[model samples]
Target chain A: MTRRWFLHPHAQVFLSVLLSAASQVLFKKSAPMSADASPFGFAAMSSGWAWLAALATIGSLLAWLYALRFVPLGVAYNLSGALHVIVPLSCWIFLGEKIVAQRWLGIALVLAGVLVTAQSAAKIEETIEKEIEEKP
Target chain B: MSPFAFALIFASIALQVGGQVFFKLAMNQTHAGRTARYVPALAAGVAAMTLSIMLWIGLMSKFPLSQLYPYEGIERVMIVASAALFLREKMTPRLLLGVALICGGLILVTAS
Candidate 1:
């Protein structure tokens, strides 16, 4: 394995998040046709979308695995909320779909919340590290 | 898609978006029904999926879930702009304003 495999706890989490974002973008780019449109479609049609989705789902599972190593489950789960904002906006923009102004505002609020949460976590980590260093 | 949605839910959201992109491309082709028409798009989707799984595995191995979760907000911002640029979608001024507000709020929150 490479040296990078042994990343700091925080960095690992960051990587996972970055990958998750990438997965979402790619998944959005690769979807198959609708079920309603394909009356005679086999499992392959579903698999096309399912497989791509599986990649993202696997990303989440991996994130969960990494997260368990350092951060509390509650915190990790909370961070996953960011996907709520990212996924929809991506759809609206890339799919040529419409999103109302009010919904946009909601997305902003959620982003704000996430930032606040992250800041709090950083502070907590620092405090914890300092206390540990002071101990004999 | 509900941002709260996780795992399968999130995946479904991505698939829907990806599907639409493919549909649009397929429509533009002379033989829309031909499997060949969708190959590129399908390939792109699969690539995306694979990347996601890899990233998730890496993340699960290292961080506290809480700390990393917030990055999703940043991802959202990226998606909006990317979609507009790549998909030729229109972003209303109000939406842009909303994005700006969110960005500002996120900055403040993180700075604290």
Candidate 2:
């Protein structure tokens, strides 16, 4: 797999992953801070941590947009799948959350899956580029 | 628990997938203001996502988070399928494997 895409600022996929995962964790941690989390809970909406989570979400969204400009939607989506593991693992470590054994196994599977996906993405991109060249 | 709620969940998934696809289409545009295509796609995407959020809120009121969480895993699979079909993106065996693993992992994680 080429490291070029990883280093490219325009790709931003890696950065998107980090920011999105952070947003998930922040949103989870801040959920309890909201006294009432109903559809129209004005007090819950104004919580400081909720606002922080919202900011993180906005950052993640912008990073996603930036990344999409460079990468295919499929590859970008697959790369971000690692957040399934990251958010929970970070929560277990930082938030003192309890994770059962099965969940750990699942997380392991996800990490392996993401590695394979990342490798596949470069190969696919090369093929697509080749196709584009051959056609024109 | 009813068919209608499940339908709402499915609609939400469709909307989310639609929004992502349109956003991709929007960004594929070369010019900022001139391309009439991207703007419509962008507007539709945002509108779909906004409606999706409302559906999700409705779903949350009816079902437990754990019950509804599996749909997010379902979403991972759908978006890949979506890219393949609508965006004409290539999908490989490893990519499919990755999707399965991630979905499985998401299910196991949320089940806990």
Candidate 3:
């Protein structure tokens, strides 16, 4: 099989990530106003919007299944939580949402942190490869 | 985050941002008595968003918060690119510099 044809587990994980990102943008753009728009409204207001949200949720579940097939649990969890920083900031700029300077700085720091973490991970992989090679 | 993990997180962030932009565009098409026409697009967008969230939950179930959080930076790059391409948003020198700094930082974090 050609290298491209081979589904590297990591590639699957990456695709899932991309899908997840795309889905988020779509859903937010389409989401209906909250049913509980009132000061004390308790129930969710129903519309076609909720149904769309449900569809997005299903897509996410499918992606999760693929992600779990190869990636370890610990790694997946960390990656998802980090979305908190990414999704909101992107919305600020692309969607014309207001973002304060402090928040922007925080986002920058988060990006820097990701790079550092990735580099460390690569070093770990290198060490592991060397150790495997050295083994009898 | 692992490289794969980082990529996934970044992608998810980008989509979330994109969704917001799409919704705004759709909403801008509003006119009296035309809410029904836009329903289909809205539905699709919502589905996509929910799917993204589900993916995130799945990732969370498996990984630690610290490891996954930094990959969010990838969204910024994606958003900036999208804005430039689709929205005709200006790419100011300061913004470009910011993007570079963020990229470098993300690389450092990932490499460390």
The best candidate in terms of DockQ: 2
lDDT of 3 by residue, B30-99 (tens): 4233767656655655665655555554454345333454565565566567656765555555445545
In terms of TM-score, the best-performing candidate is 2
Give lDDT tens digits, candidate 2, residues A71-112. 778778878887777776777776676779988887888888
Clashing pairs in 2: none
How does model 2 fare in lDDT? 0.70
Off by over 4 Å in 3: A1-6, A30-53, A123-136, B1-112
**Clashing pairs counted in every model:** 20, 0, 54
- Pairing residues by index, what is the TM-score of model 1? 0.42
Query: Model 1, stretches more than 4 Å misplaced?
Result: A1-6, A21-52, A127-136, B1-112
Where does model 3 sit among the CAPRI classes? incorrect
CAPRI tier of model 1: incorrect
Report chain B TM per candidate: 0.54, 0.84, 0.64
Worst lDDT window (10 residues) for model 1 chain A? A35-44
True contacts kept of 1: 0.05
Model 3 achieves a DockQ score of: 0.04
DockQ of each: 0.04, 0.41, 0.04
Per-residue lDDT of candidate 1, residues A1-136 (tens digit): 1343344345555556555655555544443334232212233324454466556656654554444344433333335446546655665665554656655665667676556556556655764344324431
Tens digit per residue, CA lDDT, model 3, A60-82: 54555444333332233223433
Q: Which is the winner by TM-score between candidate 1 and candidate 2?
A: 2
